[model samples]
Structures are given as structure tokens and as C-alpha cells.
Target: MKKLLAGTVAGLAMLAIPAQAQAQDAKGAIQVKLLGTAVLPDGKITEVKTDIVGLPAGTQTEANDNVVPTLAIEYFVSPNFSLETICCMTQHDVDAVSGLTGAELVSDAKLIPATVTAKYHFDLGGAKPYVGAGATYFLWVDVDPGEATLPLGVTKTDLSDEFGFVLQAGFDLPVNDSGLAFSVDAKRYFVGTTASWYAGDTLAIQTEHDLDPWVLSAGVAYRF
Candidate 1:
């Protein structure tokens, strides 16, 4: 009876090995991740289109960094290819850097970076690494004029909704037998926006800026 049980256990182990190998190439898998992301952006003015405020000659601006919660979803089309999208909202403040240091230019500017990516993943031992590129649209939710700008008769501030591109790279490490994993991702965005400040019917300031930002994320992922 002992010998018979041993043989049965060996046969089951052999079958499980082949099944596990086949599962690696299986399609129709979905992964969802809850992540914390840090958004680091450069908001330097590229061109001052209309500066009626009599700005300084060496005026420079920068966007403050923000950390926000993000949710990512992915669908596997093949063993090595997948498509992904993320949802998040972030807020920032545009402040003067060089000419008028520490002066607030725009406050409580809310942004939604809508994005999607087509990723190619490579399995390196127990770690899965991926690279992706995709399109993005920057949607401005709400913006407020800063205290410094309010004194300039500024009644409203608006940022242009722009479309751009993004590049992404990340990796995932499995934790256990369950479908849970740890993921880390980094994305670089090539985007820009036109900032406009208005006082009633007059355009007070309009500047073209490079809103290029690096988004770094890390969190837990579950596959289904």
C-alpha cells in the first residue's frame, strides 16, 4: 500500500508540472493594481505669448510635485503582450522659481492624465519586466488663481487640455501561489500646456509651458 501511494503521488506531480507550464502561455488574463504615484513635472515657461502684467525679464516658473493614488488595469492579449490604462487625479501649484522666487503663480490646479499603453512583457526567471508606449490626454478639472496673482486683478485661470505621448517600463514579482504580486512602474511623459490668466474679458497672461513629468509608481497587483 505504501509503494502504491508513492507512485500515485509521483504521477500527480508530473501532471502538475506540465499544467503549470501551459498556464504561462494562457491568454485572457486580467491584472489590477492599486498604486501610489509621485508626479514630478517641469513647468518652465517656453514662450511668453502675452505678458501684460509687466513681468520681470528673467522670470521663470516651476510646478510643484504631487503624490496621489492611482489605479491601473491590464489585459493580456498574448503571453508577452498586454494593454493597460490608469486612472488618477493630481493637484499642483505653479510657483515662480528664478525671477520672483517663492511667489505663487497658480494654485490648486487639478489635472487628470488619461492614458493607455500597449506593453510587451519579458519573463526573466521569477520577475516579469515590461516596456510600453502610448497616448495621453491631459484634462484640467479645476484651477484657482494664486494669492499673488489675485492681487493683479486676476479673476480666472485656465490650462489647456493637451494630447501627448508616454513611455513606460516596469516589473512585477510574484509573492506566493496566489495571484498576488508586487509591481513597480516608471513613466516619462512628453506633454505641454498653455496657461492663461484672465481678468474679466482681458487676458492678463498667456504662457506656453513644457509640462513634461516623470510618474513613478509602486503597489500591489492581483491577477484574475
Candidate 2:
């Protein structure tokens, strides 16, 4: 009976060693997270010059807020350092605001922002807080002027691709003994673009817009 009990104790000890090592090995592992993100855009069009009928110079433009589902992949170089890349696409409605007539002209656009960040994590017992900074390359696509701007003789709009900077901060809370954690993150992107409006193949207006936006996200992260 004593020999059988000793053998069972040894077996359980051997199993516990591998489980502890597996948890420790997760520190330098790669992780991927799926996040639900809210993109709140505070954008403004500046230096507007137009020759499209009643729309005069200095007409401004604004962008509406949008939400998107996003994904991020992270590689931990060390326990305290990691590199991450976030991917998502957001669509915003653009409105041309006239100070003279108090009329807002509506248009639509789709934006895909590619961002890469290097982060430093702080160890806080069960919670980890991180901060990062990166750059974003914004691709503006499918710019369409709806019927609202057709009467103003606006045919189409084109936006130039832009590069910008981003700042981020977030925290992760461990859910259990496993490698899963709950994460909440926020990032700010400072971006702008030069847009050109065309009226039947002729350039009608040129404007520069500051498309600074804030992104907030929350999701679960699994460390491998």
C-alpha cells in the first residue's frame, strides 16, 4: 500500500511540472486578438477652393463616426516588449458644409488604415498595462458623391492616400489560470488628405482635410 501511494504521488508531481512550464512559456509567445472597435472621427476639411456653381471658396467638410470589427497580431520579443500590427477597415460619410448657405452636401468613402506599433508592457500583478506608438498608412477608396451633391454639379471625388502617426494605450486582465485575458485599448491617429472634386472629367475643387480619429476597442487575447 505504501509503495502504491508513493508511485501515485510521483506521477502527479511529474504532471504538475509540465503544466507550470507551459504557463511560463506563454510569456514570449505570439498572440492574436479579435476586437470590436469604435472609430470616432474628428475630421475637418480646410483650404477649400471650388468653382462649382454656388459652392464658393472656404467650404468645409466633416466626417461621421463609424464602428468596425478589427484584428491584431502580436509577437512578444520578451515578457515586457512586443510588436503588434492591427488590421481593420472603416467607412465614413463625408459631408460638405457651406457656411454661406447653411447646407450640408453628403458623400461616402471607405478607409483602410494599416498600423504597426511597438509596445512596452508593465507588470502589475494580475494586470498588464501597455503603451505604444506607431505609424499608419491610410488607403481611401470608393469615394462616391451621392444624389445629394449631383444637383451641385459634382460628379465624383478622389482622395489621396496619406501617412500619419498613432499613439496607443491599453490594459489586459488575466481571466483565469490559462493564457486568456481581457483587453481594452485606445489609439489616436493623426491623419489628413488632399481631395479633388471632379465635374464630368474636369477638376472643380481642391481641398485639404485633417482626418484625426480616435479608436476604442475591447476584446479577448489568447497567448500561445
Candidate 3:
């Protein structure tokens, strides 16, 4: 199923297909959405692989939430079936949550979540409710060592990018005859990554983190 979905996305991309609207002509359409998104991540350290700095007992971490602008495009294969993807970049910071409060661990980490999903829509009057599932790749384009790590002689910090799955639910409500609609979407992502801190050439801290995030979006969409 993964291979099939991946191939379908690749084929669609190569064809340069544009999104279509559900309320327009129906068969073939295009839709462009401007969305405001909130990303909430759980950045708890699940296991400590290496910790040369010797973290204090009861130490735990949490990733700060962020809100950003997102663009969404949808291709309607049929009124009941469509493919959607979003474009956005979000930044976050990780800090000690338990024992070492106010201590920064990871700073200014920017991520691009590349995703694609297949959705099944249910039409009810002017509103369409949908459910979807897809794959995502969390690309960490930029990351910095936190201020708290400087005193520990930390020179570099890194987060591993990994593939994950996402479950989605959304609704679109048409306002009038014109191709304009209001959209609300929510996605739950099941993903994790490895975090590493380096002190010059030596590995200082290594841990596994559960980066599961809940992404919520709301916006206006134009259909053509």
C-alpha cells in the first residue's frame, strides 16, 4: 500500500496536476487555500542513549508549540476522492520541563513537513467532511545548540529526520455560488526522532524523542 501510494504521488507530481474544487464543476477543478496552522509537539526523551553531561534526576523535556502560515492544494480525482498536500515551515525550541526548569536544550530548530494524503469525502449539502491518511517526512533544515548547552561545552546539536504516518480529518463549507469556502483541518502525526549533542569531536548526549505532533489548521479556500 505504501509503494502504491508513493507511486501515485510521484506520478501526480510528474504530471504537474493542479488542485480542483469540490463545489465547482465537480469533475475537474482546482483549489488554493491560505491557512493558519498550529503545531503542538511532544518532545519527551524516551530513552537516554548517551549522556556524558549527566542529566539531573527527574529531568524531562518539552518542545514549544508554534503557529505558522500554510498553503494547501487539493486535486479532486472525484467529488468523493481527492489528494491533498500542504506546504509550510515551522520552528520550535526544546527546554527542560521537570528538574531543570528554564534550561534550554534545543534552539531555533526549523522543520519542513513534506506530506501527501488520500482522502475520502462525504458530501452533505454545501459541506464536505473528509478523512485521510498519509505519509510525512520531517526535514530538519536548521537546528542550533541551546544556550544551556554552551556551558557544557556542547558544540553541535542535531535531530534525525524520519518518515512517519499521519491521520487527518477536515471539513469544507461553501459560502455561495462563487468558488469560496471555509476549511478546518486537523492531523495527528505519529513520529519520533533521535537527538544528539556533540562536544567537539566527542558525543555528549544522545536520546530518542517522541515527536508526535497535533497539527490544526483553519483558512479560506478559493476554487476554480
Number of the top-ranking candidate, with TM-score as the measure = 1
Lowest lDDT 10-residue stretch of candidate 2: 98-107
What's the TM-score of each model vs. the native? Answer: 0.89, 0.82, 0.87
For each candidate, what is the lDDT?
Answer: 0.94, 0.83, 0.92
Comparison by lDDT, 1 against 2, better one: 1
Q: Candidate 1: worst 10 consecutive residues by lDDT? A: 20-29
Q: Write the per-residue lDDT of candidate 2 for residues 1-224, one digit (tens) a residue.
A: 99999999999999999888777866547988889999988668766655556555556667789888999999988788899998898988777565533343445688899999999999999799999999999998678874556776887888889999999999989897677889999999999988777889888767788888999999998887
CA lDDT, candidate 2, residue 32: 84
Instruction: Write model 3 residue lDDT over 18-134, tens digit each, in one string.
Output: 443333446346778899999999999899999888899888999999999999999878768889999999999999998789899999999999999999999898788999999
What does the lDDT read for residue 167 in candidate 3? 98
Over 4 Å off, model 2: 1-28, 49-58, 97-106
Of the two candidates 1 and 2, the one with more favorable TM-score, higher being better, is 1
